[model samples]
Target chain A: MTDRSRTPAENAELALLLEVAGTPKPGNVDRHRDLDDLRFEQFLAGSVGSARGLRAAADGAPLGGAFERAVRGMSRQSGGNTQFGCLLLLTPLVSAAAAGDLTREAVRERCRVTTVDDAVAFYRAFEHVDVAVGDPPEGVDALDARRGSDAEPALRERGTTLWDVMELSADPDDGVPDTNAAEWIEGFPRTFDAAEAVLADDGAVLDRAARSFLRQLAAEPDTLVATTHGESVAESVRERAASTLAAVERTGSLDPAEALAEAFVDEGINPGTTADRVAAALFVALERGLAV
Target chain B: MTDRSRTPAENAELALLLEVAGTPKPGNVDRHRDLDDLRFEQFLAGSVGSARGLRAAADGAPLGGAFERAVRGMSRQSGGNTQFGCLLLLTPLVSAAAAGDLTREAVRERCRVTTVDDAVAFYRAFEHVDVAVGDPPEGVDALDARRGSDAEPALRERGTTLWDVMELSADPDDGVPDTNAAEWIEGFPRTFDAAEAVLADDGAVLDRAARSFLRQLAAEPDTLVATTHGESVAESVRERAASTLAAVERTGSLDPAEALAEAFVDEGINPGTTADRVAAALFVALERGLAV
Candidate 1:
């Protein structure tokens, strides 16, 4: 395989960028040309520079200010909650991986990647990364591993779209007219479109993730308190997890097509998952907004 | 004050919106605007139509559907839980309030604004609507409420900014950088700045309130399963709450904030506040976040 073919990080970056550029017919648009047209040339260029720096650091390429150190420093500073910082680190890492500048194994060793396939990738990454990033739990993997154990769709191909997963249900109490499943589904494309716009504009995934994560975190009691100070972020997170699970259960009974986020929380809350303790709470809220 | 001026719903909307719009000029340009730079036009239009219809309805004047509904519906929806809808409802209401259409009594009835201040006059077609937005909880009123609760600086009055109340601290674990009180204060101006662009482009006080309310709700888990649906949402929420309280207790020592949250939760979970449960959780989070 060529250097490009050998590098998963490069592949991931291309895939992610392609996902951004692709939208409908990802390949049709001259993504490279529009990179500047959209005023994202700087972000893309910065990614490349950061990617090279990451690879140089990972390879121990006699680098000064290696990403590894940045990661370690950020992790410690976050009180081990590197979810926010990790994204900053990973955006570059993924780009490097896509550029054939870094090895997947190296990236995993530096961190850990149980599976990047829809189920495995999300669940594993959830566990491996810090809570401030995207902590997933250990038990949460049973569902994914069950699928992973069988291997049907390849990684990146299997995850369900927000539209496909969200199910609209009529609440017996919500007699007020207007909003419906169709309206809800319609909301998704718009929100995703908006999210994409925001992401492209602000390449700082950590800040975005922090915002996204906080959107969910803001659902639990004292989460605002916990967020300002990490002292009880995990606990507030856990409480949020339980609350979300219950909501999912309610929504599940109310709307069958809607994904029940409780299972993910169940998995995430399990201490064995490392970060599941925090992930359990976060995943549900994130999923709810995803449906939007 | 005219009898119409005494309407609580109108007063509440004016009080809250002006309070938000004037919030000591966090440096967010949105703070300086005519109709919040037109971001909440739809909502404002809706409320204005509601207000006109209301006057017509009160006077028993002949009116069109839009106007009639606007006049009739202003006081229909219960303000039990501020975030009753999926989207956290506050933002839309903010737009309505900012429009300054609803009568003072209407605003007062909804938000229960206590002080005898501009919230009443700001919205009236005439002056001195009998609106009295309520007083803040005892100690919370330590800051002179009568003097400067307005979101904006009164024509020439000097007042403390939201910056005065913010607090921050550094973390000793995980090496995450501490969030400083000064930094939060500093960030407020920037947040205000970013918010202004949105105010101009689309959102303002309503959006701010909605986001803030959503942030509060996001921290308070939603799925209250049993009564909500024949699901585990309530159970999950309860479990998470217990866990969160536990985490709060575990983190170093129990501060006054935890006690407040615990009190709210204890009351909310036991007999249950039902619709107000989310509000209870949010209040707990805000209080906890506000604790010194």
Candidate 2:
């Protein structure tokens, strides 16, 4: 409510402007408990689809048919960002975040199911349907309204959450991959070589187990950094390594070994052989220690 | 990320933007997941003066500090419409939506005492130190440097969350209050007449039991509307009611009975006396078969 002179549209615009620019109304603090839970849900729900999904789901029935009519009616008032966020939160993102396992790919693959059914399943599981519509306005009805559109149309933008897919791609949501084959890959072996080469150059920066991790990082930067760096070094490594790779990854062809050589050389971390470079660095560190 | 041509700042920005935004690189995804967890925890773990709550808690300190900072930070972000929204949410303006009970304030309060000492002192129990961390950043490492600060600081501006407090003004974080007294005062038979007067047109629009919830609504319209119209409406009701009450409350001019009578009469719901005014609409709603 900016000034008395504002119009309805101005008032509406003010609401948004105030949103990114307003101050707190300290006098009337709601201070309720479920506040966080409610807000969290609001920021996260909603799904995406297309007229095709709607048509397929409807089998090309008339738009005003009983079910289709309900769908049409609801869609008119159906919240856009709110609904999208809900679908994103309820379906893709939850699986990405809630997967039993801890890998990025697993999280992504699991979240690929961004269908209404996926949302229904998630809500049924996540929200206690037995929950009473006790609060005024009783928003659980929207859950029912949301379910009504299950067989309804969706937007492409709503299909998958950017956040969820990103997470799953890097980390497996659950289940470890078969590293047996992963370790044998020859292309990645070069990274380990480079790591060893760097280590060989500056074992001065190395430690006892640090050599092993460095070797690991070089061998399979994905799993190596994923497991070793945890959140910190892993994130930086991936980003930095990607930058290096991007510079070389041009020409539209991706070769793991080539990517590593380019990234490693670009980073000034020698790219030779994984274990050898690791050994080279650790040997230097150990020798420096021994000399001391 | 911004559709701008390539630059170093853009390059660095893109890496974070892509990792956070999710990209082709596999490891980049992992970083996103870790950062997201931090983003979600931004409010919960945020401290009074601390940048991030998860980092602070992991480093070890009372949970209150981070959340308080989040509250202050979030409050600062919403510049103008705060009062407008607060007024609508407080009064009966947004009577169409409300979600649940357990609010962030309650949880924030929960975090305040998430320590072994506090738990032992009050509940006479103890929890593991990292219990406050909830689930660890799904694929994150504790010692990682990249996790230090991400888009989480920016995510902190999402705006105020008052659903819980609107439903129930007394927050768990503010220490104990005689909520039993508040509850008793709400449930008294003497409230129905006041309820009728407040119901505007009639107890007709509200479910029977919904009338009973009016006093609770008055206490915290924001939370009750969580189930009703969603957050927007919840906020509207609170803002309107608060502004009206604030306008009249300080005068101490009108007799309580007359003031309440006028409020109900204005609503077109007639109540003969203060006591009748409280009971009048509630009885009408119950008689009309509107379920709260």
What are the chain A TM-scores of the candidates, in order? 0.26, 0.18
Off by over 4 Å in 1: A1-84, A87-227, A245-292, B1-292
lDDT of 1 by residue, A1-292 (tens): 1010113222222222222221111101112112211222221222222233344443543211243332322222112322222223243244333434433344333232222332232223223224321111233232332242233243346443212211211111221111121223232222233344334433222223223322333233322223333435446555654554365346632122112223322323211111111221221112222110
- Let me know the DockQ for model 1: 0.01
lDDT by residue (B94-160, candidate 1, tens digit) is 2233444332233223222212232222212111111112233344433322333243343113332
lDDT per prediction? 0.27, 0.25
lDDT of 2 by residue, A167-248 (tens): 3322333422212112222212332343344434431121222323333442343332233334354445545545544543
The most accurate candidate by DockQ is: 2
How large is the C-alpha RMSD of every model relative to the true structure? 25.2, 25.7
Off by over 4 Å in 2: A1-81, A112-292, B1-182, B185-292
The deviation in Å at residue A48 for candidate 1 is: 7.6
